[model samples]
Target: MKKYALATLISPFLFFLFTNCNKDKSNTEETPVKDTIVVKIDSVEKKPITTIDTVDYNQRMIALSNNDTTGRWPVKAPYPLPGALLPYNRIIAFYGNLYSKRMGVLGEYPKAEMIEKLQEEVAKWQAADSSVTTIPALHYIAVSAQAAPGKANRHNMRMPFKQIDTLLSWAKPINALVFLDIQVGHSTVKEEVSQLEDYLALPNVHLGIDPEFSMKNGEIPGKKIGTMSADDINDAIDILVRIVREKKLAPKILVVHRFTQGMLTNYKAIKTTPEVQIVMDMDGFGSQVLKRSTYLRYIYKEPVQFTGFKLFYKNDNWNDWKMYTPEQLLEFTPKPSYIQFQ
Candidate 1:
């Protein structure tokens, strides 16, 4: 099984791809350029044409990290996982609170309009790589935040069952998967995960743990960022693993969103099992260069089962620059497999 890193960029496909990273060196090989071109006859032209190979992302990154001719710093390939989920795959997801129009596409647009927006994005990704399948998902932030705070006054709030059920119903009609994300404000992963057991039992449902609001100490979620140790992540993994085994369902996907180093602690200790797939998503929104830098610093630097990228519909589009298209994102050595739009 090969461990993979996930990279995702803005709205259109919420696309991300999988690639491996190896931090420690056990073997060495000659480095290769970021991209290699090959000539092939176009079906329509009947003439040989040169095209860049996008599928060799894993190999290209390995070459850059392990073998470098320049005296610059050399990067190391991420550790390989026993197995990964993407074979040049992509996932386009609409993320936000279904209840608040300010949150994401889910609530920003009417149901009909939102569905249309998602479908349009799907079409774009399919056009980019017809061979790969694009999964449409409703990335509902089940638990959101509030200023007044409740019960624990942790600022971490849970979405009502009614709201989640409504979104699940919408996803079902489109044959989309439902991702229930938890902020866990002033709460523990164990506690948060345990409450969602019933929903996790569903075959199409998945999980996402956001460390940004984890509040490792006693800091407020909005006041400052938080962190999650490998242990915290493992607890969520264990819960999903058990659910998958007991239900005899397909492997469950768990996405952990991150952008900064402190958002996630202890990368090496994080483990993946047969029952559950883990994706380390770079959840920051910025310009193309800034986004790429974050990917290199975290997703590539710290190897995980897979990588993911998040695109802010408005935030990423700042500075009058448009969002990154699927074709442009494929330029990365290891393409991101999971993508989310907010």
Candidate 2:
């Protein structure tokens, strides 16, 4: 009688415990994680991404590093890109604004010889397989202050609109790239870049930011210029990319000169504009005390193209241009993109 009574009393407790367990499970909430998807603003669809496609930026890097059949670095773009300009290479040259002038007598190599020389360089590049190819030399025209005194000093600073036209005429036939360097003024970044809208319209034309003359707010360049702010540079490059895209021009390169970190105070703001190239030119003018070390440090730390070099033509060494040739410049662990001769 006692055992039966105990069992009857515990039945209510057991039933309550079972009811509480079911209630707890019913109240619980759970949700599975969704995969990351890029919503193409236009399509508004969720496209699945494979693991390799989503994560292997490194693989893409390896492919780009590998040389093409011509032993040249191919850019991430449509193949057979116009001009034999290697997408990535150690040395892209700097041709003078009026490098090939058919001055005085009839003609030696015809004004087109400079173009021919560029072609020859490309031929040499094609001979090698997966070897380091040299990018075609680039000619930069300085229109503002903070220009290099000896190399692109005040005297030779501005390339008149007419001279620029001649260069474009020659460049088009050979498919050469040109950079129009500018020193920021009191005007905003957009305002300054706006001035060169016509030039920027061309496929080969691009902009270069010379920190040497980039001014602080209200300060004049060349005299007491201040460091460039990150936002100012970022906005400038962003606008340049938009222009290139809307115009259907080749990918424009935004070149920034930096000898030290202070030169570009806000580097993080530099955005990766689609199809636009970002090159950080380490323009160390003086003797290369740390040229090798700095090139290794900076190039590895930031994978941007490195440029600029001083030659005998430099104000300090113009008389000795012959002493240091292109071969000598290539001695750097990774060669320079271009050498700036005075």
Candidate 3:
């Protein structure tokens, strides 16, 4: 894990159905609405104790085994959005903050230099799997964290629209997608997401929610790893669904970052919709062994519609750290369609 300038800014340790465009909401599976979830405010007692249904260990092993007759756990089924970029191919993203140098490769190098480095990475994946069309992306943190609170009294700082537009411009020449990530701090996902509606309306722009910095209980981000309940996750989904339907555009991709079990709760209750494709990314970095363990622990056990694996160039080196090659990662039961490097 790369450290953030604000100790609280460090990213903390951190799904879907198919339906026709004309499908009726009444006919689809009904998940609990916001009222059902006890939104924890200040204390654990204030937050209702929600129980997550656990999958048996043996079942998880089976899910990880590629012994199924159908073969391949169905590649990105139904495609998250109508004109989607992922699942059909592999998405390789370079994540970081342009304002901070320590965040990722995107910021560590100059613009021309960063694009060159990203193109180099894109080349490696293109060679590794010529069959899969590779798409490059800029994973920008649009809403950053602050050591001291701003006027909102929330430790979050939002980037100006022009700044985001500038970064989006950089991705155009390379034909890359833009992922506008949000770390809500004391704010709610819905509140943070609403502000990015303009960006989300675009086909190439997607969304990422960082639970580590969510700080659901008003604590500053990066202090202690924070958590997001299923209800909170649903808020983002609803926003995307409305945008996709109203704009009459393609489906949107929502990437949720997770490392520990507590980072995200009430996994089973998450709703799936055809308009919004959700990806649960294994955001932890470590030795190959540790990475594999974390992936199996949460990703395998609590399965989502699609899966993603993240690689940290500097941080993963923490423990005898040798990064896993693309071929090595593809060896998993259901190969992850989304891959991110920071």
Q: Compared with the true structure, what per-residue lDDT tens digits does model 1 show for residues 1-342?
A: 111134423322111110012112111211123122121111111121233243464554443233434322122323222222343346788887654566667778999999989888877888876755676888987765333345456555666566667777788767677889988867789987877777777766789988877877777565566689999999998998888779765567798988777778887788667677777788866678868987878776777666677777887787776778888876654566788887
TM-score between model 2 and native: 0.57
Model 3, TM vs. native: 0.78
Q: Which predicted model would earn the best lDDT? A: 3
Residue pairs clashing in model 3 are: 8-221, 8-222, 81-251
List pairs with backbone clashes in candidate 2: 92-337, 93-137, 149-153, 312-317, 312-318, 313-318
Query: Against the hidden true structure, what lDDT does model 1 obtain?
Result: 0.66
Which portions of model 2 show Cα errors greater than 4 Å?
A: 1-91, 95-135, 146-160, 217-220, 224-226, 293-342
Candidate 1 Cα misplacement greater than 4 A, ranges: 1-85
Candidate number with the higher lDDT (1 or 3)? 3
Ranking by TM-score: 3, 1, 2
Report the Cα lDDT for residue 65, model 1.
35
